[model samples]
Target chain A: MFFQILDILGTIAFAISGVLIALNKKMDPFGVLIIAFVTAVGGGSLRDVLIGIQPVSWMTNMTYVYVIFGATVFAVLFRNKLNYLRKSLFLFDTIGIGLYTVVGIEKGIVADLHPIICISLGTMTACFGGVIRDILCNEIPVIFRKEIYATACILGGLTYFLLREFMSDTNFVFVIAGIIVIVVRLLAVKFRISLPSLYKDKP
Target chain B: MFFQILDILGTIAFAISGVLIALNKKMDPFGVLIIAFVTAVGGGSLRDVLIGIQPVSWMTNMTYVYVIFGATVFAVLFRNKLNYLRKSLFLFDTIGIGLYTVVGIEKGIVADLHPIICISLGTMTACFGGVIRDILCNEIPVIFRKEIYATACILGGLTYFLLREFMSDTNFVFVIAGIIVIVVRLLAVKFRISLPSLYKDKP
Candidate 1:
């Protein structure tokens, strides 16, 4: 129940983020929806493929398409109104990361992979979609550049496992971990915090 | 033995395609290599995932990395000589489409899917990387706009199935079908031939 709700929210939030980025880049309606679709489900799609899931998650169900299309319409209509999204975009982005991380980890657990792989999948599902979206938009991925993005997912995933061990209530564990991730990501963005670039020779 | 040789040639050709595209885009040296790497392997990687292959082909072999890097260095040093690419690029690209189609179809066969899925995978493997590369470069995919792109793979794959049913020597089948695809694509390019666009609504 908790997961289903979080999954939908993550899709919406990620779609919104992608749409805004496309708008910022002056993309058309079709292009904006492509961005939104990739952002909302790219990582999970990749994960499902790696783990050998068939027909993929999104192709089987049309809800994700609806979400992306709805988000596209919303973004196109409200594009001018969203001009000031530059400042508060991180808040919505945080919720996306947190929710996607949980869903990815859960999917991994269901697949019965090793815990380490679960964490890796969780991190990827939380990050790579945005990376794909940004790259296709002709920009460096946000995770590669700023905001301690994947870091928040890793930490949150660890916290998820820890809470799972201590608290038998799966509902409470997921809720707490999800909130922690969102809060950490929010603070990271609020403070403009980021990791040191491995290749730090450039401005 | 034949598929192996074709696969290696296709990898090199795909890498060159990527390197040239990145250079044209004015990416830095590392950036160029990364783009080339992804472009060369992206279609196959995507194909593997869609069909539920594990570890991803590039990740498992690591040789794919070496192939992309080698091709990148060669392309970079000889950038000024790419006028010759207009001459040889067609041959290489056709060979790539032919080889990739075979490999994609084989993967689907291994996964026990239907003939339609095999054809789709073959086409995807042959064409999807270029689609991704063009999208990342912020251009509409050249294949989607240009002469004889996915059509080459579709025809080549059809030839493959026909040859497989009539003959058992894998090398003979791969080579014959490959030449057919290369000839078809080259003739089309020489004639400036193409299919109709689905999105063109103009009267």
Candidate 2:
């Protein structure tokens, strides 16, 4: 129940991030809605597709649609009031990643996929929405450029698996692991941590 | 044999389109490469995911990677001289859509999925890459906007299935249907044809 609440909050956070970027780009309202919707639901869409869920999550769940709509309106109208948007965007984005990582891993476990695939799914579910957001904003995806974006999620997912092995209390494991992801991401941003470019032939 | 050639041409055309957009966006060499890859392979990725293909198309075939690589290099070097890009792009993108419509439908048929899902896959395979490209370029997808994009492919797919049921000459049917998609898309662009906007929700 706590996780679900946090998950909705994360979705709202991501949606706000997307809408703010769209506003920065001076997109139309329809385009802004799309940006919010995609950013909020894109990662989970990929996860749902891979897990063979028909109708897609956003299609099946009206709650996500409402969250994105509400977030968009809030972000657009309260832009000045949310003066810390630039300062707090990363934090909200990181929180979303942490929540998504936990949910992704749990979903993968439920699907009975291999541990390796589960970790990959967790990382993907955590990072891909932001990736989609950055891409749609005509910028390189944050994860591909800054390894820290994905690194934090991977570490959290790994910790999740380890904790789940010993700590039978699932919610506790999720919360602690989520904190690990949020901390790692915040630290990475605070310290400007990133990966070295490997551009010998990558381009 | 024809489908193989068409697929290769479609990939090159799509990669070239991506390179053009990357150039317009003033992307770096790595950005160009990444966008090129995504534009060329994204539709197929969505198709594979939705249709539940194991390993995915690009993952299973290294040749697709080579095609994208070669095309990206060609596009970057010759972009200045490609005076006929707009028309050529429309042509090849249309051809890719037509071929993938058939390919996706066939795959779905083999998998014994419902006809509705198969049609959805076909449309996805034909249109989703361009959607990704436009989204990455910070625009609502061209397909979703105007000029008979997905609509053309969907119409062509319907024609192909109808022709397959009624016509005995498979090769002739394929050629005729491919031509119809290409011609429809060309005429749409030539005549400024487009779909009505569904974006008129409450502002």
Candidate 3:
């Protein structure tokens, strides 16, 4: 029940973010709605498809679709007022990623994927929606370029596996792991930390 | 047997194109190889996942992996000489999309999806590899901007369903559909046809 609420909140956060980006790109209403839908469900759908889940989770459950639609409408209507809620939006987004990371890791574990693969899946689920959004908007994905976003997911996934070995309560481990992801990202952003550049300065 | 050969050739074409792009970006060897692999199989993998196919096609068949690797190496070694083979590369790419479009349509048909959805699947299979490649290389997807590429696949997919109403031979239909895609794209390029812009002049 708790996770479900977070998932819905996450979907709302993702959908709103998609709307903001699409509006920024001056997309038509249909395009904005489509982008919002894709941002809300793309990662989870990708995860489900990868593990061979039929119809995907969103198709089987209508809640996410409705949530995304509602969020898009709300976001579009309140676009002008959204600046006042930026901090709230960021908090929701952070919590969304934290929840999504653990959710992806759990799905990978269910599929019996390797630990490394699970970590990858976790990071992918938490990050790829933004990646797709950026691609459609014709910008470099913030996660790939400067953010510590995916790294936080990876660390959380690693923590999930590590905690599993020591903790008997799986639910407790899940909550802890999710919190770890959220806290790490929050701290990283607050400290203005970033990953080292892969390329050196051109001579 | 013929389709399988074309599939291999298509993989090679896609992989070589990926290498060319990665080289242009001055990516290191690992980045180049990753791009080639993604370009060769990204579309098919996406299709498989959506249809709930486990392990994906490339994971089950090692042939694509070997082909992409070999193609990447060959393209890198002959990079300087590749300008002379641009026409050949273009032909191969055209053929690749043709085959991939038909293949995706077949998968969608087998899954008993709607014709409209099947057409979307076909277009996705034929064009998304390049879309993903451009996304990774931090550029707008060429198909979305200036090409008649995906339109050809959609047209071919429509032809498949239309021909199915009269044709008794399934293989013949497949071949015709593939040929339609190739011919449409060839004609579009030769005639400089393009999709009309959706946005009006700002001024």
Candidate 2, residues B57-149: lDDT per residue as tens digits? Answer: 664466788899899989888888877676777778778877777677667778898767776777787788878877776777877655687
Query: In order, what fnat does every candidate score?
Result: 0.22, 0.13, 0.31
**Per-model TM-score of chain A alone?**
0.87, 0.88, 0.96
Tens-digit lDDT track of model 3 for A112-148:
9999998888888888888888877787677777868
User: Highest DockQ among the candidates is held by which one?
Assistant: 3
CA shift of B80, model 3, Å? 1.1
Best by lDDT: 3
Ordered list by DockQ, greatest first = 3, 1, 2
Candidate 3, B1-203: lDDT as tens digits: 87899888888999999999999999999999999988888888777778776688889999998899999999999999999999888889999999999988888888777676677678778888887888789875666556678888988999999999999998999899999999999999999886653446531
Question: Candidate 2 — what's its lDDT?
Answer: 0.77
DockQ of all models, two decimals each: 0.13, 0.11, 0.18
For model 1, the docking class works out as incorrect
Better of 1 and 2 by TM-score: 1
DockQ of 2: 0.11
lDDT value for model 3: 0.85
Clashes in predicted model 2: 0
| Candidate 2 residue-wise lDDT, A2-73, digit = tens | 667877878888898888788899999999988888888888887777776657767977888888898899
The pairs that clash in candidate 2 are none
